[model samples]
Structures are given as structure tokens and as C-alpha cells.
Target: MSGVSGFDIFWLIFMIMMMQPILRQKFLEAARQRMIRKLEQKRKSRVILLVHRQETMSLLGFPIMRFIDVNDSEQVIRAIHMTDPDVPIDIILHTPGGLVLASLQIAKALKRHKAKTTAFVPHYAMSGGTLIALAADEIVMDEHAVLGPVDPQVGQFPAASLVKVRQTKPLDKIDDETLILADVAEKALNQMEYNLEELLNGRFPEEKVKELAKLLSQGRWTHDYPITFDEAKALGLPVSNNMPEEIYELMSLFPQPMRQQPSVEFAPSPRRTPPRGNGKSLI
Candidate 1:
């Protein structure tokens, strides 16, 4: 048998590397088309739109559609018109909160629509992203689906993140479990209510709004830890509270997928300052 020369080996390696992107792009486009097909099969859209951003491919790598800035509201509106000028449209969302303003706009559209508008979050929907989900007539999340704490987590103004602006003392300095009996989770949740009040001011009444905000923020925040589908139901989001036997068997550590858009929070990736950084890098 004849063996290939060293030059052939180098050429082969380069060829393989070049082929990777082509193959990946083809796979991605196919996946996008498949998702659209699945939504079409749902039978509820005169205009069926599947909107995914940073959590998926980020709209062909547009910088504006950053991981946290999903300007989906306008996109959804446009898709509805293009797909079906007169019929109702269905939009699917998968995002990890990107831009607060963008999320709010998307949520507003969902709430204003008289037609049936269903929001499906197959993965985690956190912060402002969750706001968009809240506007939906019905939300579909699996038993393992995760919804992040709605507490505004900011760092550009390390002075304003939920765990920051409010804590007069350092948060990491947050006393250990035994010393902190006030359940940080509960307090943060109360704060979440206040923030939502400002965001949804005239949208819902104070009493109803407060109740809605508290229930949604009803749990602790920890990375890689998600509430069971039942736990979310108890928290009171308008999701399809079902847990099929198969999904229940899967580990609950996985985060729900979320695409991002752009905005203040996404302007710069926020970093936690020891809640009291000494103006020097700790790591």
C-alpha cells in the first residue's frame, strides 16, 4: 500500500478545517428550517414564526442581535405580516435575557395582540427575557424548564445589580446561612416586585401585579439549578404545567435555552465586583 507524503498530510488538515465551517453552516440552516417546520405543524399560525437569537445562531451573527439583545418584537411583527397578512401569527422564543428594553417591547406586542399568542420557552428565560414570556397568553415550558430569577442583575453599575445596589453591605459578605435568617431569596423577590412595578406601571393593578411578581420570583438563585416543572407551576407562571414521565427522569441541572438580544445590560458583559472590589483584580 502506498502511504501519503507529509505535504499531503498538511494539505489534508487544511482542507478538513475549511470543510468544518461549510458543514456547520449547512447543519445550522437545516436546523432552523426544521424548527420552522415544527412550528408550522402546530397548526396555530396563519403566520408561523420561530425566533431564536444568541441562544441559537444569533440571526446569522448580527452584532446587534447580541446574546442578550433579542430585538424580537419587531421581527415577530414583520414575520406575521410576511407569512400571513390577515391571519394570526405564532412566535417561538428561546432566550437568556439580553436587552431589557427589547424584551419589554416583545412582551408588549404579545400582550396587545387580540389573536392567540403562545410563547414557548424550551430553555431558561431569565431577567427581562422572562418579561417577554410573561406577556404571552400561554407559556409552554417542560418539567425541566428553567426560569431565572427576575431580580435585575446588573454590573455596569455594580451599584445597581439586584445583589448590589440594594445591599448596603457587601453581598458576598452576605452572612452565612445561620446568621442570615431573612432568606435572601425572599428579600430579593420583594425587590423584584418593586422593579416590575416600575416596568409594568399602568399595565396591571398594584395588588395583582405584586402577587404575580412575588410568585415568579419565589425561589433561590443558583447556577445550574432549575426548579422542577411542578415547582414552576406552584410559582404561578402561565405555563403548561405538565411533566411527562420521560422528561421527569432527566437531570434537572440543564438550563432552558434562551436567545439574547441587545440593550443596556448587554452593552458590556457585566462582571460582579466583590460587591466591594478594592479597585484591583482578585483573580
Candidate 2:
């Protein structure tokens, strides 16, 4: 037999390099599934995850930002349908939010589930993500995790802002296009406020429900404002800071798409205190 040539070795190396990403992806998927199964067993609930992150394309290395969309809603709803009606459901949410229609669809489906539902936030669930979390009976978050306002956005302007412009500006000064957008903005605000009230209705006093709905949907804060754990509690949400350790472990598996150099780095293990008068410690 002829000995392998340098050209053959080069091709072999190239093939292995091409296969590496595929194999890594498969391994991550399997790890995530195993973690989900373990969580389900531990909590006796159906586990679902609605995680969105920027992922890089393997060929072009261009980053694509993910969000809640119709497809995501469909898959989540299907998962809920597959689950037994009596079984509790737990959804882990980590997203920067997405389409209002998709978020509402998910929220309504979760609301209709007969069994108790929980939303877990290891980092943040913002905008539309907050909308879905509100549908859950309980929201579990890491101490620093956050939820954001659900105020609707119309084009580049906030719906509430557009409505304010209509209210504060003279009709003669407003352009035809501005008037039209303001009209749409008014409708969007009203629809979002109504939806929020509906979600909070049975869970809180009628008056409190209305209050929360208005506060969340009326653009009282910036669209990206973070409502911390304490603030959420103050706002009368069903929020807690008892996040599970396993959740953090699972999130690690879904790392941000690789960059030439990572933006953040640290020792991966917890540090232990040294004994009195001793300098040595475990990490």
C-alpha cells in the first residue's frame, strides 16, 4: 500500500475541522436535554425553555440575534399540549423579548394551563419576556435577574410617546403621517393595557390589576428598564429569588457564540474561605 501523502493529511485535517462544530453542537444539545430531564424529575413538572441568544453563523461568522417568534410560540404551545393537564409546568426564560403577537400567544397558552406554571429567570426576561412571565403563577429569578416594562413600541417611537404627541401637540402642527402613526399608537397602547389587565385580573384585586396594567404598558419607564427582584416584589409580582443552581449549570451549556476573545472570564469554581490564621484556600 502507498504511504499517505501530505496532501491526504491536509484534506483529513480540513475534514476534521469542518466536523468539529457539528459535533460540538450535538453534544451541547444532548447536554441541555439531559439537564432539562433532570430538572423535570427534581421538580415533578414539565420543563420548557424559551432562551434566545445571539448565535454566529458557522460559515460567515455573522451574529444573529434570536427572539420570541411565532415558531417559538408554536413549539412552546405544542409542548404544553403534550404535557398532562394535571402536571405542573416550568419554563425557563432568558430573552431580550420579541414580537408582541408571539409573546401574547405564549402568555395566553400558559395562562390557560390547568396546572400551576413557573417562569425562571437566571439573568433577564425583558419586554415581551416580561409579558409571558406575568402569566406564570410564580416567577423565580437569580438575585440579580431582571424583568422589563411591556410597553408597546410603534416603529421607532414608543406607542405611549406617540399618543402623548397627539395629546400635547396642535392638530394643525402634526403631519398626516404623524397623525396616522399616533392613531395606531393609541390602539396599540390600549390593546396592550387590556391584555395586561386580563393576565392580572384573577390573580390580584380588580383595582390592583388595572394599576399594574397601566403602569407596565403606559411607557412610564424606558422600554429597556430593568425591574429588579425587590422592585418586582414591591410591584406585587409573584417573584422570588430562590433560583436553582442547576439552572445556572444549564445556561452555561448554551454559551454566547464564540468570539476571537471572550469579553468576560473568571475562575469557574467557587472560592472557599481559608481556615483562621491559614493562607491556603480551595477554589
- Work out the TM-score per prediction: 0.56, 0.94
- lDDT per residue (tens digit) for residues 74-110 in model 2: 9999999999999999999999999999999999999
Give each prediction's root-mean-square deviation over alpha carbons. Answer: 16.9, 2.2
- Please report how far candidate 2 places residue 58 from its true position, in Å: 3.8
What are the per-residue Cα lDDT tens digits for candidate 1 across 1-283? 8899999999999887767645655766566565555545555464233333422223333222334455455676556446533344555454556555566666666566666666655556665556766776666776556666554433332112334423556657655752243344445456656656554445557776777666444434542245455766776556794322322222121212333752333443447665876788876
> lDDT of each prediction vs. the true structure?
0.53, 0.93
Candidate 1 has an lDDT of: 0.53
Q: C-alpha displacement of 271 in model 1, angstroms?
A: 43
Instruction: Supply every candidate's count of residue pairs whose N, Cα or C atoms clash at under 3 angstroms.
Output: 18, 0
Clashes of 2: 0
